[model samples]
Target: MGQLRDRLMRRWTTARWTRRLGAGAAIALMVLSIQPGLGNVTHAKGATVNLVMWQQWGGGHEKKTLDKYIGLFNKSHPGIHVSEVAVTDNTKIVSAISGGKPPDLMDLGTTGTLGQWAHDGLLQPLDTYIHSSHINMGAFVPAGWHAVQYNGHYYGVPFMNFNVGLVYNKKLFRAAHITHPPRTLQELDTDAARLTVIKHGRIVRLGFVPDYPASNLEVFAWLFGGDWFKNNGRTSTAALSANIRALQWEQSFYQKYGRSSVKRFVAGFGQYLTAADGFESGKVAMMLDGEWNIAFVKENVKRFQIGAAPFPAPAGMTSRNGTSYIDTNPQVIPTGSPHAAQAFEFIKWETTNPALAAEYATLVVNLPQLKHVPQTSLFKDPNFRVFENEANGPNAHQLPQTAISSQFATNLGNAEEAAILGKSSARSALQNLQKMTQQEIASTH
Candidate 1:
């Protein structure tokens, strides 16, 4: 009976040992699974990584086109799932980042904003990624490459490029007995004066209005051999003589056509997107606009006859004929993105793959930043050719990359408006703008 009891006791001890071993093993596994960067424990092959992207192109066909490409990317990359969210207001993005929940990828609509963000240390420097992917920085147009850079570090990738050009009405030019588009600033001014039509002391049609549609001080300033900054964006040049001259030139339009009359005439125009656009309806003969205008004209005005030309330069400065305000929307990764490497992979694929790049640009009717993509048949249409040519031109430039770039632009706009409205002389307005921009720069530092 004692021998039988010993056997039963031994069996009980063995059972208890087995249970303890099993529990210990289970605990180990639980700890391992929670540990980070352990292969198979934290992330396994074929495991899905979800990423979110925020973009400004959320309306109309832009949204549809972006979604189509995103869907294609997801299908092509089974392990990576990218969900797109449309966020047009940049302030929202700022708030998200400050809250430590920024999207994995963001498409800020201008390089200026990208520069400001990068300057604030809110972006990831892409040098390592660029080197790992063997991206040829020279493949991008010089202006585009310049746009995405700040303090010698690249924080964004160029997506679509657009430049200002002189879009004119061919029918109107022919009616005015002008055989060719103006080649110089003087010619443009003379053409505009001749094209101006006054009916019974009321201006019926205007040939050109400098501040119509939108006022871009950079456009006019660049055309007149002036820039907002000097010494590689280290100093404000708002009060320089060249910029003053540019503002005066803009004010001349209001001076020539009484401001009150011009204001009343401008009020008569309909919204820009509709068929009654001043340029489309023969109310304005010439204007400085971007490549996207082609798509707008094609969609809205069926019978419109238009001609695209390099924006004219000052007469003696003929070299600036093709000089334009080249702008780009850069794709960026926020600083705290968990899937930065994956986001960059996507950006490299989208920007470097000629076929995909061309497809995206074509759908949006924007110029592809890739040198070869612009040569594709999709961009060979005459309406887009002029912009493509200008993209390669020598004088294409982006706004200066400064921390206060947006504020600087706003101040310049205010100065231009003040000058145009005859409230202040061009010199005084620019001087005040320079003082304000300087103060902003100092405060930011």
Candidate 2:
């Protein structure tokens, strides 16, 4: 994309987007073999390919950006029509694919769902088309394609990307008498204690509590070197001791102040976009969260001194350069689609054609998966480059790419909850996770 950066300053795309070729449109752009205007377009001759897309990353605005790509694709290739159905929620992709019906294309949110799909034989490999088109995989940022492969075949074509980090409040830290944000677990604990405020036996404030449900727990698990899977990611083993340590750290606050009290406070917490967020209302001193919240914080929470840093680690442990990242959304083409060939043609044009990628990305904030696309003002922020850097950082680990990854996540969650509730020890949880995950993998086959 470095060359794209050069072309970008002029605000022009390196690829052409046009319905009719006047002189130089690439032969890569193909209309439906079934020519249109002969009969009702209800049938599929030369008609535009119908595409159903699932948008998993970014906020609502991200969906709008993808839709704009559809608009551009439609305008440029009037012969090939594309229809998009909006679906977010990165977690449910397996169900969507395994439910025996899947969209023509979907964004797999760096969730490792693409790998799983490829392994399950649910996704078609595009190597044939890619090689023929001379598409350079090198143009995309590494993470965009790293997790897209499983057992040597690639199922997904990369789209947008993201990375998670720590976001906190400067005003809240100052009020808690914390001069510096925590860099280690000890400091994190000390800051949490200072930030905790209780009145009438009711908790008024708490520190940045690790919201385990949100994938931040994975970062902590990585810290302890205890992964959620076993056997090179063919099975789940979420009950690892590292996982237990992480959960213990996560639940430590509730244990310190009392879960009941914390629950009561949370029950009354207000809207997330408004003042209800702990960082927004001065209710929390720190947080381990994602980058999108940056826009939300800047947009919704005003008059508060906010800042972000890498998550603090335990003593002698340095928070790594990147994180337990799930970035790079996956765009897949469903099998048995009537417009398979046409759909593929549109995919090649939309993803490989720098013009549509640049135009669509202009409105979307996520990093474009297409190689050579530039980071532009279209993202609405200059600091977003930080997220892109983080995605390329070493701390990132591809989530287990297997058909049962979704189920493994579920089992891993149970192990996490068991430890959180004092129902089991971390060691036993890990062992049980291993056993159950192995069973699930065998059963799925």
> All candidates' lDDT scores?
0.79, 0.62
Q: Which segments of candidate 1 are over 4 A away from where they belong?
A: 1-46, 198-203, 267-276
TM-scores, all models, native as reference: 0.83, 0.77
lDDT of 2 at 312: 59
264-360, model 1: which lDDT tens digit per residue? 8988999874668788888999998877777667667898887889989998999888677787878899865656888898888777877777887
Q: Write the per-residue lDDT of candidate 2 for residues 172-281, one digit (tens) a residue.
A: 77766778767777787888788778889878778766662154666788765656666767666566667778777866766787766665666576666455665666
Specify the highest-TM-score model's number: 1
Kindly report which residue stretches of model 2 are placed more than 4 angstroms away from their true locations once superposed.
Answer: 1-46, 88-102, 110-112, 115-121, 177-180, 212-215, 235-240, 267-285, 299-306, 319-322, 353-364, 370-386
